[model samples]
Target: MQTSSQLKRLGLFDARVPRYTSYPTAPHFKPGIGAELLPDWIRAIPENEAVSLYVHIPFCRRLCWFCACRTQGTATAEPVAAYLDSLKQELATIKGLLAPGIKIEHLHWGGGTPTLLQPDMITDLTHSILNAVPLADAAQFSVEIDPSEIDEARLDALAAAGMNRASIGVQDFDPMIQEVIGRPQSYEITKQAVDGLRARGINSLNMDILYGLPHQNTARIIDSVEKLISLGPDRVALFGYAHVPWVARRQTLIPTEALPSAEERLGLYYTARDLFLAAGYDEIGIDHFALPSDGLAKAHKAGTMKRNFQGYTEDVSKVMIGVGASSIARYPQGYAQNEPATSKYQAAARDGRLAGAKGHVFTDEDIARGRVIEELLCYFRVDFSKLADELSRPIEYFFTMVDGLELAMPGTTDLSGTVLSIRPEARPVARMIARHFDDYEMNESGHSQAV
Candidate 1:
């Protein structure tokens, strides 16, 4: 029922908005907050508190046309090996500032293709990290897997290093679409990867699929989702493809004429959403799905799910430390990111310093507004009164934009008493509504489409 008319009325074509994965999104980060702040943020963590670690492996064998991530391609191991050594240096620097006996509750390895690491490299990297900040007994380690780049040895190594959760990227199963996007992975290849990970005793698995591809239609999306379901992944992420060629240069290779219209994209999403719901997958936030037994689903029901640079996560650690090139870390004080380029990151690490390049320092108001935005993103509703009590501010202080949003998009938002909720029909544009409260100036032109 999300037709073109409905889309235009809702500004589905409105210039994109920040995904609100982090308050004062990365685009708003400034150079004034840089490397110097890193050690202090790390040292400020309360002693013995569990923290989350995100290590970025920014090397890939092939550059997919649709990826917007910060990654570089390498033909040989020289560059990847060099990057890992730099990472080791960065880890050591962080280790020096960390409180004695500090433990990690969550550890994540994100692409470009973490499996690109050789088995021995994985073991060495694991040891270096564990030696630095050791994992808590029940800490969870997760990695993003590329079906084409991973195999038995890598899986065995990851298993040995304590990777309990694996997120596999599928994008789509249509060979034509895969060809156009420059990422071709057959169903058999994906199954083998899953089989390999499962055989290694990795119990949690997440598979990613995309809608709004060049030629994706209801049939194509349904077929892809069905294939994904057959894999029996515990969690599935159905993402709307954002064609931001201006930001993601590789996306320029995808012909604009081949992209689905906003309305068609909506249709593809709803088609897949229906199938996932029918398969007993509970919808988690806008783009993720999880089985009833999945922790994500449980977190949402318990009103504790949170948004991060990695999209929605059940990991609620107040401090998340990001290592390696281009990774972002979240601190109670603010956010810090390492250098985006491999060479620069290596230089800083080799010099025995944090590779932080840019960051955002939160103001009291930024933090309050961030709380409201986060609650709405996770629960689709916010209790203004509760937020006020938590922040010790007036109710109006927390919702300065609700009235304006209600006026601008009538019937799209509800403000009765102290509870703010997007109407049921307006759930898709919740992120757009959430943006109204962002006091930080943003140029929406640079963001991705809301749908």
Candidate 2:
């Protein structure tokens, strides 16, 4: 364990860095490419291969102060119905352009709260997406559930759509933290939500919780983790609370002074990590924990696990079509993001065009570097020779990049037989090290703390 002084020296508290969710991160995206590049990338999907789908639902009943996601609170279902229609239109447009015989191997419904949709709405949306791109026989379907918003009808609709896995949000069960964060949910309700999903035959579950919230001491987080463990979730995502008030205006409501210090934040993380590890959970990457029998664990063991907008994921499809407001789609050639506003996305979808407003076109160098960065962040080490061979670049090319690598995290990298890895104790600085391969300029204000 590092002391406060040691952490300070390493710039853990003061440094700002991208999460490397996408190499070139989202901030570097610009206009003009959406019209020119997105279609080319979509049309270029490899023949007959299954792809992944991500549908974003941006409506929520409540706005949690700590959340920085693109979402809006709605009082009724009128807008949701309109959004669903728009989503169907968007899928139809994509279907007309996409190559034939491609199927969806993984489908995810992320939200504001996917369960906010009424039963009929859920049924129609699922049916529409399937009509456009059918699910593969072994497709994995997952949705994010909100305990307060879910009920029998909503769950029934999801089950009918063949949702085999569900990821529930429980961002600290301590009443004080919940009150401060403006997302008050009782443990009983969450358990009932889990029970309901299980009753519907949802085989896998993932619970998301946060550390570094207001008034979150070690004991409070420990209690939350204990309760979470009792529910038998196959996976758990313990995320550090990113206080980006500049981006999400609602975060200004949170009392900044009440948050834990950097040292305390690390303590909170270690506390939860130790508890989860003792309970036989294998730590996957930096922030996720999974049981030994979970698919995430299997992926990690096989070195196929990947990081994306949703955090550590096992989805391996070469193409990911994100179809919703503010959704970012990933193609081998580049990244394209849908319009962020609900009305804009709806309008674009209605017009039989993608909701793309901004994007980045990947160059050959960008693609090569993206691969190395992804491998480094996912595994804490990268087999440089393997990536170099895969990208058809010379091995010495990475040697020239090592100077920038050290600048990101001094004294943390080592080279041994083409394996480039961060020192074990410096794992928290992996994000910094990954930036070494980023060809884009750093936008300091567009990121969060290094830890």
Candidate 3:
């Protein structure tokens, strides 16, 4: 077995790296590619294409010290109500641009906390979105909800709005960890929230857990995993907290010295994985777990699983339509993001324009590399021979990238084969391995933690 010191030398517990959520992560998004060219781009979306939808609500009741998501805390509902108005206007603008009766295969509402919307706002927003881009018969609708933010009124609104799945935020139940992170929802409160959502017939649930936070350890993770199992969520995402204090200002409040070393972080990951597997959960990818029956696990078994900005998902729509502030939409042609600032996004939409800030237009090379990287990330292996045949390039030509990487990590060349793969035990280092296929090495600073 490799010692912790040895793994540290191998970059096991390095500072943050991109989650590989995308090949060219969001930080690579460049400005100057504004809404000037959106009309033609939106118009270019192929007719009859079934697309996915993502709506971002940039407000939270309270800010967590470790959170890196784009969100603001408010003392009153006035700002939230105003933001909803902007969302409605943005929807109207997008509706006019979209081809009518387009099939929406998947719709997701992600942070700052979609549950923070007033009951009436939830109803109106979902109604308006469905009216604009009708959901397909098989469309999957999901939303991220903060338990404290959920009430009978909001729960009813969510169901009425056609939300069939819910992802609850439960970073850690221990009071010490909660205090350190500045997110203080109790265990009972989370349990009640899950029970309440299930009682109302919304049984498809996901819970979020974290490792590598200040004061987290193997014992803490083991205890938390047991508690999570008792909660019986259909899926669990063991996210490694990414602390970029410079970028996410709230994170500065956390004391840097209290954080775990790289070796400890890797150990935490192994411990968590062992605990979940022993509990009968299937490891879906780098950080996601699900019961064997879950669609995600099933997708993984069938080789149809896909990775997106929201992490691993079963929704494989070719097009993803993002609405609301800081949301990103992915199309066959390229990726686009709304303005990050709330005021700027609202203004762009109120002015009847798509709020595209900066995004990459995919080239054939990007698509090819994206596929290879995604496959390697998801499965921990890639068939280079098959990829070469698909790209009409000799397999040896692709190995040149491997040769360049070999000088940095010689073990990789020996382990990788016609089917490039790392050892099963080296899954956490998967992102570091995938970087070999990245076309651009200059954009590495934006990546998050490597746990």
Candidate 4:
């Protein structure tokens, strides 16, 4: 009760903050960092080094009301087929710019449903990507598989193309909640997908479940979590439902009154969290859990874990190239996002130009602050002395930014000898604490609840 009081007093329930997936966050990304700079950025990649690739398939059979991702619903294969061609063109353009010997260490296909692709389309897309930059030995190829859209033929194609890791989104298994959220994937369908993946020797799996959904209660979340546990995913991402109907207009279809209160939302998170821990899953940063043998767990234990647009990751590659519309690539120089509109992105790629539309070039201060934020979020602590050495700045360089953090968060953080740490009990407020280090202005309405 005292801890709950402290959390309430600290405004954890009321505050809305950026997820801090990126330091400046996407909303603050400005224009003018588009196509012109892409060639130079791609050329700067050193030969013989491994980089990550992210392919976005923005087409879905149906749009879920809770999602705010850049996606469109297409019932026909015509638009998808057309989009695939443009994606291939974009890959070819990237291939033209690459230096020899560059290899992909981590390849992820995220979506509106990468599984929406036909079996042949999957093989062809995989071939195009591999042809551009071959996968390095031991490279990890992961795809976001939609249970409702995938089947044996597609699984065979993915297996043949070397997809070793599969990520599935199981928001909740409850029928009522599924109906309310417009994502009608059932536990039976989800299990079928998992069974299919395992039968194909693709045992490495990542699953996502959500808390704070409309009509979610402790009993409801417990039931969903147990069902997810029965599926035995290698890694699980328990995310809080980010209800921003203003941003994701489709979310308006969900009744606002059905949503859990901020305090109830936090309770739901802890309820589900305790279940994962009790099941022998090692906590991986904020919302992720991994079996001890999973790469993510190893990364967390070894202190090499990183946070990106995809949330917690073990990939340490310095360069991550994103293909397809609305995809963002991270180069050492800065972050570049492709044209978000599929038509615009396709036109640019077909015309033999990169589709980069908006980005943020990292200033020195941006780098320092971004590292601080990343460290805080990933490890729940920032060692200023270590960062100073790594960044080649004096220890005092971070003092000004961190000054008064304790007061702002009020007993949630401990600053000792230039190192700042969020107490274990205060981890729920980590995003709010990270907000203090943000140099840019934030519109609270643009973010989700702090809890």
CA lDDT scores, all candidates in order: 0.87, 0.86, 0.81, 0.89
Q: Tell me the tens digit of each residue's lDDT in model 1 across 200-292.
A: 788799999998899888888889999999999999988888888888999989998999888787788889999999999999887899998
| lDDT (10s digit) by residue, model 3, range 1-451 | 4566756665656545567777677777778564766666667777777889898998998988899888999878899888888888888887788775577889899889888888999998888888778888967899998988889999999988888899988888878989999999888889988988888898999999988889988888888878988999889998877778888998989998989888788778788888889889999878899999999999999988999998999988888888888888887777788899999998888888888898877887787778778887788777879878888878886665555454454454344477777666556666776766676653354222221
lDDT of 4 by residue, 1-451 (tens): 2366677666565425678888688877778786868789999999998999999999999999989888999999999999999999999999999999999999999998999999999999999999999999999999999999999999999999999999999999999999999999999999999999999999999999999899999999999999999999999999888887778899999998999887788899999999999999998777899999999999998999999988999999999999999999999988899999999999998999999999989899999989999999899999999999999998888987776565566677888887889889889878788887887843353322232
What lDDT score goes with residue 86 in model 2? Answer: 97
Worst 10 residues of 3 by lDDT: 442-451
Candidate 1: Cα lDDT at 234: 92
Pairs of residues at least 3 apart in sequence or in different chains that clash in candidate 2: none
**True-vs-predicted CA distance for residue 265, candidate 4, Å:** 0.9
Query: In angstroms, how far off is 96's CA in candidate 4?
Result: 0.9
Model 1 segments beyond 4 Å from truth? 1-3, 13-15, 442-451
Candidate maximizing lDDT: 4
RMSD per model, one decimal: 2.5, 2.5, 2.8, 2.6
lDDT of 3: 0.81
Candidate 3 ranges beyond 4 A from true positions: 389-394, 412-417, 442-451
The TM-score obtained by model 1 is 0.96
Q: Candidate 1's error at 62, in angstroms? A: 0.6
TM-score, one value per model: 0.96, 0.96, 0.94, 0.96
